[model samples]
Target: MIDIVLLSLLVVIAIAIIRMKDLFAVVMLTGIYGLLSASFFVAMDAVDVAFTEAAVGAGISTLLMLVVITMTGRKEKSTRHKPLSALFVVMLTGGLLIYGTLDMPYFGSADAPIHKHTSPRYINDSMEEIGIPNIVTSVLASYRAFDTFGEVVVIFTAGIGVLTLLCVARSQKNDEEIDSINDSMHQQHLVIRIVAKMLIPFIFLFALYVQFHGDFGPGGGFQAGVIFASAIILYAMLFGLSTARKVINQTFVQVIAALGVLLYGSVGIVSLMNGGNFLDYNVLSSNPIAGQHLGILLIEWGVGCTVASVMVVIFFNFAGRRAFQQHKKQAQDKESSAC
Candidate 1:
């Protein structure tokens, strides 16, 4: 019953987002959509997925979208193009998806091939094989370790792509323009600042706990990274981008992001050097179980570093561009007034 209500809310939010002309409203609706989806995940007993959705979708992604809208303007331009083609494409895709589902096993069916085959092995043998009681962690960090490495690489590549598109080379600007932008960026709410200052340390401590506690529970590197990034983002919002940049500059972030991918790959290389296949954790130590633990820990740390740095770098680039555009607009206004 609750799942149905959440799904219905999600559908309504999606339609509202489509109909809304205000970009700000659309961004807010999107956050609402993420929250509803996270709730649905919770109803389905996927707490880890719900955690991710809440953090990335509802929190970080919404913040980024809001930042982008600041520069692009709050109102969407009217489109002259007809929607018939788009409607057709959506309907066609939906029909195909429904058709594909016709061949799938009934929900939670014991006879489902996935349940009959691979699920049993992971559930039955993960403890002895991977030395982790958490089946999901064991499968993701051990059995499917290569795929996780690929995911990290993909995230690293995405961060590089965002930088390529948004980051500008050093250009000369007058001190007045710099000062104007800096002055405008500072938040005036002392209460918010004080509260955030008190919370940031606890947020980081929780991130570390999630990173190291994944072997035994529902938290992991991805969640930890996003949580950590959120703390930095909050600081940037409350204090100023300049302050955040001073704490961890874009160049440093880029370096850390790349290093994370390299670190994960290096673990694989070490495994190979120790006479095991790539990403085989057994060779990391004489005790196979200990090696598995060590390998998962290192890889998870690499993942956390890459994800946190990439998110922060992306946020910085967006915020920086917005500031630049605002400053340019202000200068143009001043010149026109002088003329």
Candidate 2:
């Protein structure tokens, strides 16, 4: 009974998302839909899945779409599509879902086929096999660590891709153009600047906690990385780009980014030197428990540092050029007026 109501709500929201006229409004609705879906998943006992959807689906995707909108322009063209084609695609997807649902297990039944096969092994052996209390953590960080590492690499690649696309200084003309755009905001928002100054330190502290807290809770390198980067971005937005640059020098940001990966890689090298497998943490400290904790902590810190630095670097490289150009134009305008 509850399932039907929730599924109906999802379908209604999905339709609304498509039909919304305003681009920003549609984007926001999509985020709301994602949050609702995450909540529903949590109600269904899929906590980990809900966490990821809440974080990535609602949070990251919305933020990124907003970024893209800002970089391009505020408005979106009303894209006209053939109604028949849209209907065909919808029908095809719905048919597949309907077919798949026929084979799905009954909910909340202890003797379900899925529980009989997979859950028993993990339920029985997880504690003895892995030291971690959280089965998901053990699965992610130990058993399928290669996949986690790849996910990190993929995230790194995404930042790199954004850097390549937006951060890299393409042409002198483009630089000049960016500077021109930046000049429009010469009169700064004093309130936001003061507020950001007050908040940055606390944000950094929170990021550190999130980085190191994964052993007991649902956080790790990835969450820490995003959190740290966001703090820097807030600083950049509140203060002028040049002032922000003064605080986090371009050279310094680059060095820190490079150092982060090197720190991570160096851990593995150290493990190898200690006559252990790559990234094996037993040899990091005299006590294996202490070593494991230290190793994970260090890697999380490295990830946070890199993510934060890289995000700010992207903002600066792409947007800073515009600000610089704007300042130069403003200065020239004043000089000409005085003369």
lDDT of 1: 0.88
Clash number for model 2? 4
Q: What lDDT score is found at residue 329 in candidate 1?
A: 84
Poorest lDDT segment (10 consecutive residues) of candidate 2: 178-187
User: What C-alpha lDDT values do all the predictions have?
Assistant: 0.88, 0.68
Q: Write the per-residue lDDT of candidate 1 for residues 1-339, one digit (tens) a residue.
A: 898899888888889988999999999999989988998998988888898899999999999999988877899888999899999999999999999999999876778888777888898988998888778788887899999999999999999899899885545464346545666655458787898899999999999998889889888889999999999999888777766777877798889998889989999999999999999999999999999999999999899999999999999888877767766788899999999
In candidate 2, what are the lDDT values of residues 1-339, reduced to their tens digit? 665677788899888877876778777877888888888887886665676677656865676666556555656567687688889998999999999988887778788787787667766775665555656655665445446556656556665776666543344664455544544563467676677788999988987776677667766666667667677767666554655666777878877877877777677788789887887776888877666666666766666677667766766665554544445677799899999
Cα displacement (angstroms), candidate 2, residue 7, comes to: 5.4
Best by TM-score: 1
Give the local distance difference test score of model 2.
0.68
Query: C-alpha displacement of 278 in model 2, angstroms?
Result: 3.6
**Using lDDT as the measure, which candidate wins?**
1
Off by over 4 Å in 2: 1-10, 41-60, 79-81, 109-130, 168-189, 273-275, 283-288, 314-339
